[model samples]
Target: MSQSTYTVQGMTCGHCVQSVTEEVGALSGVSHVEVDLPTGLVTITSDSDLSEADVRTAVTEAGYQLAS
Candidate 1:
């Protein structure tokens, strides 16, 4: 598996973590997730090729923005 980290903005609490985790983790190739609220870092584990664009889309769909 491979991993990637994304900075997600507009998350404030555990509910935000849950929301982003569920949305991102449900995508194909996603295997695991770690969200760090203080740093706005979301680490994702995937078993196959997954583009950063897809991750950004997932974050956006969950009502957040992926930091560039």
Candidate 2:
């Protein structure tokens, strides 16, 4: 499996974490998603490496943005 960590901005609560987790986890190859609220870190594990564009889209769909 491939794992990727991204820094997401605008996440401030459990609901934010849940939103990000749900959105990112919905990706086809994604196997797991973990969001650390305090640090705004999102870790994603998948069957293969996921494209940055896809991850960015998922984060946007969750109403957030990835740190640049």
Candidate 3:
């Protein structure tokens, strides 16, 4: 599996983490997702490397922004 960690912005609570987790976890080949609400860090475990655009879109869909 491949792992990638991204910092997200605008996450404030458990709901934020849930939203991010749901969206990112829906990605193809993603096996796991962990969201750290305090640090706005999202760790994704997947079968293959995910693209930035895909991750960005997923974050946006979850009502957040992926830190640049």
Compare the candidates by TM-score and give the number of the best one.
Answer: 2
Q: Model 2, range 2-66, lDDT digits (tens) per residue?
A: 99999999999999999999999999899999999999999999999999999999999999999
Give all candidates' CA lDDT scores.
0.93, 0.98, 0.96
The sequence of per-residue lDDT tens digits that candidate 3 reaches over residues 1-68 is 99999999999989989999999999999999999888999999999999989999999999999998
Candidate 1 TM-score over all chains jointly? 0.95
**Estimated TM-score for each candidate:** 0.95, 0.98, 0.98
Model 3: per-residue Cα lDDT at residue 33: 97
List candidate 2 stretches off by more than 4 Å: none
| Comparing 2 and 3 on lDDT, the stronger one | 2
Q: What is the lDDT of residue 45 in candidate 3?
A: 99
Best by lDDT: 2
What does the lDDT read for residue 36 in candidate 1? 99
